[model samples]
Target: MHIRVYNTTNAFTSLGATFDERVLLGRGPTSSTIHGELRHRVGSLLPQQGNDASYAQLYIYDPASALEVRNCRNQQLRRDVLQTIQDTLLQVNPFVEKFR
Candidate 1:
């Protein structure tokens, strides 16, 4: 699988990595801000406009640290991509609190 990690600090130039399986190896410290697709099936999980966008992402909250912001195109898979993102990345499983 191919993974691309981008940092808002320098989004123009991104770091790319490849893996043989579906796993998160956790890229560099800059990867604290993560964004990208899962490779093979990524194209299938996207809106017509965002089809070219990535599915996976990594980043951090602190600009001084690794990863900063992550943006995922709405794939509209079995689950709500927004909710999936909130749950997967933000650890907001129920989303009962964040909605408030």
Candidate 2:
């Protein structure tokens, strides 16, 4: 998965001494098959920097599934991915709130 930062507020920056304006969420070479496939399909998730705000978006690729799936298998994968994202956000909510 990859999370492209959309914006960060001054309040957020004040909490940290150093901040990366952009962040990559997963640890894999961009040349890897899955990454390549996602890049091809979704284009770029990272917006031009300086568009400061407070939100991020996750973009993931499953080469075996269509972007919009009509079948059971792909639907299951979508559900699982959604669940994972929700769980992750719940786990991170407190840490995120700390910057506020």
Candidate 3:
């Protein structure tokens, strides 16, 4: 007799999605702000390389409700959002390599 075991408990979970600002707003002033803010926020989330262009809109959809935070005017709120995301990610093991 042969048997196999598959572990499905720890699976990669995607937090959300982001799209370049230009894709939505073309060429505009907000694009610049989005780029700068995205760099700051995402940079903290992951290692940043170079200064090309990371301008994007953040959309987080999970745990029932969805959240969308734009602009860097409210530094505190942006920080809070980033912290929340980081905390959540820490709590969940999104990347799992073993299936046994």
**Per-residue lDDT for 1-100 in model 2, tens only?**
2232111110122122233323444665543223222211222334357631222212122312322221232233445454454445445666334322
Off by over 4 Å in 1: 1-72, 79-82, 92-100
Reference-based lDDT, residue 87, model 3? 49
lDDT-based ranking:
2, 1, 3
lDDT-best of 1 and 2: 2
The 10-residue segment with the lowest total lDDT in model 1:
1-10
Tens-digit per-residue lDDT, 1-100, candidate 1: 1122222222222345453333345564432322454333323322356433232212222211212123332122222333343444445334322322
Q: Whose TM-score is higher: candidate 2's or candidate 3's?
A: 3
Q: Candidates' lDDT values, in order?
A: 0.30, 0.31, 0.30
CA lDDT of 56 in candidate 3? 23
**Would you give me the overall lDDT of model 3?**
0.30
* Leading candidate by lDDT: 2
Write down the TM-score of every candidate: 0.18, 0.20, 0.22
Error of 2 at 70 (Å): 18
